[model samples]
Structure formats: C-alpha cells, structure tokens
Target: MNELQNFDFEGNEVRTVLINGEPYFVGKDVATAIGYQNTRKAIKDHVKTKYMREERIVTPSGTQTMTVISEPGIYQLAGQSKLPTADPFQDWIYEEVLPSIRKHGAYLTDEKIEEALLNPDTIISLATQLKNEREGRLIAEQQVKEFQPKVSYYDKVLSNDALMTISLIAKDYGMSGAGMNKLLHELGVQYRQGGTWLLYAKYQRTGWTHSETKMVPRKDGTEKAVLNTKWTQKGRLGLYELLKTNGYLPLIEMKDESAV
Candidate 1:
C-alpha cells in the first residue's frame, strides 16, 4: 500500500493514497467532509465500484483496510451532495489537493516560469524536457484511449464491491477462511454458531463486520438467501491489529521486511 497523505479541507481531514500512480481519496473521509450523514450509504449509492478500491492503510491505531475512491469518484460524491459546503469542498480539492498530488512536488509559479524563459540555456533545457515529456504523455494517452473500453469492462467486473469476505481477507495472512476463523475464535474475537461465524458479544454493533444476504444455489436448482458475514474496512483493520499483536503478519508486510 502507498503511504497515506492527509490534507485539510476547512477543518476536515481527508486522507488519500496513491495506487498505480493514481490518487484515491479515503471514501469515508470524503463523504464525512462533504456533510453526508450516512457516509457508507452515500458512497455505495453514488460511487461506481470501478472507481473505488479496498486498501490497507497504516494509521495511528494500526493497519486497517479502507475504501478509497478515485478523483472521478470524489467529483461524483461532491456533485450529488446538497450541503452548503459542497461547492467549497470541490473547489478545495480541485484548487489544492489534486494539483498537489499531481505535481508530487513544489510547483513553479508563473513568475518563475517567466524568469526561466529569460535565460537562454534554461529555456533550451526546459524546452527539451517538456518536449520529451509531452511526447511520452501523448503516446500513453493514445494507448489508454485505444484500450479504454476493455479496461473499463474488466475494472467493473473485478471491482464488483468494496466489501471483502473472510476468505478474501484470510489470503493476506496466507491462511484459509476456516483457518482464520478458527484462529479468531481461539483468540476470542469471534465464535461459530449455527454453521456461521459471528463476532463475539463485546464486539457486536461496532461496525467491524457487515452481514450480507447472498443467494446460494441449491442442489434442486433453486436458490436460497443466506446471511453471510463480511469484514468491513474497519473490521479488517481491527483484525490486522489483533493478528499482529499475536505475532502474525500479512504476506505483504513480511515481504517488505524481508526486502529490508
């Protein structure tokens, strides 16, 4: 995961992460800052799955999974909001956060550019660099346009939702869902009942997990709705801390340490 960067928007903190060189805003942070009462519902209803991603973010509490949205997703949420601060929030993002992220460094002011233009040697060097960069950007843009349709289709398919199942979460720890469930049970995080894993009583109503009803095909070719529990980003983060405290680390973290 990329390092988390925080930006202030009128006293609200918006966290962002970079994935594959593209910036993504933390969904809950953006939604809350935009004055949404129900942040999760707002994001789910307004943001497309293709524009959202689940990533583990390291915070003061611990490493936790969170949903991050792309720039377009940010616009979509801001555009739909009816709050008074919506317009100002959009302006802040466009005029500050986005430009900062894209530049990834200090930007030259117009006066600085003009000064550089006066120096013949600097002008030649800058012109050559700009020409090469423009050419590279053009080629990349052309390739993206050519493959955009297919890429869009696949992105939609692969990113169906931001929620993650126990099985999916277990993969990070190189364990099966059953194995992870058993471990959590032993660690007093959850308990299995009625062939389903449920959080312990103390952890209930804490937004750590969400129960979703999924349709399961029966042997008779019929389908039945089954209540399935999935880990929320918050839950994933909690789990990371719990597991880490017990001396278990995710595969990625292990790999990072090994490399160091």
Candidate 2:
C-alpha cells in the first residue's frame, strides 16, 4: 500500500496517495474541497471511470475501501464546478500541492532526510539530477513562450465561429476593404459581378465565402437588397496562406524592418 498523504484546502482535508509514481486524490475529499454537496454523485457525473479506482485506505479505525481519482479526474471535476472557490481550489492544487508532492515525494519524513544525509554520493547525485531537470524545464518554458503569440492568434481565429466581412480581414492586413478587394482581383482569387465581389469558379465550391442578402439605400433614397459576401474561418486561413505565398502577410506576421 502507498503512503496516504493529507493536504489542507479551505480547512478541508484532501487525502492523496501515489500509485505508480503518480498522485491520486481521494474522491470525497476533492469533491468537498470544491464545494460539492453530493460528493459521490459529483464524482460519478464528472469524472470518467478510467480516471478513478477503488483503493483500500487505512484509517484510525481500520482499513476501508474508498474511491480515489487521478489528476485528470480532478481537473474534469473542477471544470464542471460553478462554485466561487472552484478556481482557487484548482490553482492551489496545481501551483502548490502538486509541485510540493513532485519535489518532496508526497511528504518527506525526518527518517528519509537522515538516510539521505548519511550518503554524500546520494546528495551530489540528487543535486545534479535536480539541476538538469530544472534546466530542461526552463528551456521548454522558453520555447512555449516564444510560440505563445502565434498559438493564441490561431486559437482566437479558430474559436470565432462568426463569418468575417472583407473589411475585417482587410483591417488585419492594414489595408482598406477596397484595396483588399482590388488585390484579390489582381491575384485571380476573386472577381466583381453585379457590384459584388465573388470567388473564382475554381474556388466557388470550396465553402470559403458565403453570400448574405443585406438592404442598402440607393441614390434615389430607395432601399435595395444586395448580396454581401463574407469569409469563413477556413476561407480566412486559406487566404492567409495564399497571401503569404505571394509575399504578402498580415500585419501581425510582418517583422519589423527597422529591427532587421
């Protein structure tokens, strides 16, 4: 049996155990810490079977069987919680509890420290391992930071389900709508027809552009319905690649000439 460790969260006790070197939390404790009134029900509803298991835990009374959930199960439960303490609970677990468990091996005992201190070689080896691990983590973090802007921009674009007008896409490239239309025409991507811009025959069936009818005021102050073309996210992505291939880039992707 693995050693059972306890952590305090908002005055509640969350018990954890390491199974195969990975931390797993007691389901009841986690549900209570996150303000779930019905712990069993919450765990059943939110956490999947794969992330939870039955474990035998020893208490002051006797050994008892209880449900324990893995780290992913904790996140799954936390994501569905609407309580005010949910975010703080998750933050505490990830930023403090997890790091402490990983670094100190669930909780270091005085006996364990004394054994390590007795061996000079063990201490030196541990120091080297920790140093190498920290260096690797730092390098990975730096790479993630460097790519974060591009990732965020792509995420924003993909998450937006609403269609974009030519003006909106043009604004991203630091060009006016008319300028963008003219550029697309010159590139053979689109053509003007009946006062509306449309994708070429080859591109028409690609689901890139959608046509919507909008009422506009004419010179005689009469309202006339016109077909307005909008671009889908996929279309925008296609256009981005096409423009980049032709030596054009969105303002966000353009590098500073002065810095170069």
Candidate 3:
C-alpha cells in the first residue's frame, strides 16, 4: 500500500501511511505534534519495538526508512506523552484521524484478479465466483462507511491524562457502577455478569481491549485472580460519543487549551 493521509492535530500536520493493509504513522511527526523537542529521543525512549517499526516511506525527497507507529503504538505514546495537549491530542487521534484514514485510504481495496481471468479458457463458474466476491466486498465496504459516525462526532468530549475506570465514566453520566454497566451493554461495548465486566463477543473477537490479571481479596480473606478490563483510548472516546448521543452531558467543562 502506497497511500498517505494527513490530519491536523493540535494545529500541526500529522502524516500517516498505509502499509500492508494497516496504518502506520510517522514517528517524528507524531513526536513533534505531541510537543517533544527531541523527536528521535522521545521515540527511542518511549515507543516499544513492537509499536515502532522502521519502514521505507516515499517522500518528496525520496524513499527513506522512517520510524512508524502502529495504532496500538500511537495509544502507548499518548499515554506516555507529558505535554499539556497530550490528552486532547490522543482523543483527536482515536476519534478523528484514524476514522478519516480508514474512510479515505485506497489500500482497503482488494487486489485485482483480472490477470487470472484474462485466459480465453476461463470457465464461466470461476468468473461468476470472482464477480460475486467483488460484489460482496463492495457491499461490506458500503456497510462500514454507512455505520461510521459523522465528522462532528470526532470532537473531544473528555480530557484526562490516564485511563478512565468504569466508575469514572458512570459518574460523568450521574449513574452508578451497575447502571454504567447496563449503559455499556446497551451500547454493545461490554456487559456485567457476576460483578465482572465481560467484553461483548464482537469486541472479544476484535481484540479491542487490554486485560490484566489482578489479585483481589475476597470476603473470605482469600485472594482470587480477577481479570481487569481496562478501556483503551479509542474505547473511552467511543463510549463518550455513545453517552452524549443518549443525553449524558458532562457535569464539568473540559479545560480550555486554546492558548496552548
């Protein structure tokens, strides 16, 4: 994939490139946007190897190996960023930038099968199957495009430097923890069963969250292993959007960082 997409974050241009059916962002650009004075140093110190990969990207000068960060890597960097605008910038990344790239990137198209079907002896059945496959892909693409939220939905809702717990999110909506779980269920994000937050089946299959094993003391004075469900940056923004749509307004206004 040779496609590139650019978006504005914190009044700076952030460039993303499509590589191998996935979006990889330029590390230097990301670092600069997040207010790091030393781009290479920040990436080397904070970004993990798995999150940061070196790849040859085409540029006006020429193709060169640049450090690129995967989606998860971007979130990790956001968590580590210390700049004042880090939180809001992260919200923009998960809400506006990624969706825009996925919506406009040309790499999502399937490889052409025309060469294989150019033979004179190409069977009618094979041709029909290929045609059906193309039609199915088109339909799926259309469905995805229709399912995405409008551009305005990308606006930042909450501003926090750390991950939000279930209780925190609930408190924002004037609901209890249990009530919040129900709200999450209604939004298809997760459900509560046996006092545990279980990710919905669809999200489980998609690997949208990070789970950790925590030892919790039971009423019987015995420690039991519990799986903690931590909501990612993207997941938090998504829930924020869902709540806003369902009439949940923020009790406190977010900090105004326009001057920054």
Error of 1 at 47 (Å): 0.6
lDDT for each residue of candidate 2 in 1-260, tens digit (9 for 90 to 100): 66688999979999998665457899999999999999999999878898899988776667888899977677777766768887798789878887887676333346646766898876666566556556644664454343433444455577798999999998878999999999999999999888999889989998888998999999999999999889999888888778877977677655432233
Winner by TM-score: 2
Candidate 1 residues lying further than 4 Å off, grouped into runs, are 104-260
Assess candidate 2 and give its lDDT.
0.79
Candidate models: Cα lDDT each: 0.76, 0.79, 0.65
Clashes of each: 1, 0, 0
Q: State the lDDT at 194 in candidate 2.
A: 82
Residue 153 of candidate 2: its Cα lDDT?
48
Candidate 3 lDDT: 0.65
Error of 1 at 64 (Å): 0.8
Using all chains and alpha carbons, the TM-scores for the candidates as numbered come to: 0.42, 0.44, 0.42
Clashing residue pairs for model 3: none
Q: Give the TM-score of candidate 3.
A: 0.42
How well is each residue in 1-260 modelled by candidate 3, as lDDT tens digits?
25456777757888898775567899988888888899888888767797788887777767788889876666556566657877687778867876665552223333323533465343454456546545644664453333222211333333443565778767755778778888778888787777678887877854345678899999999999988876665666666666768766444322111222
Report the C-alpha lDDT of model 1 over 1-260, residue by residue, as the tens digit.
46688998878899988665467899999999999999999999878898898998888778999999977677777766658987789779877886786462322346647867687785666566556545644664454343333333333324454678889889978999899999999999998778789898889977889997899999999998888888877777678768878988777666655764
Candidate topping lDDT: 2
| Candidate 1 clash pair list | 64-237
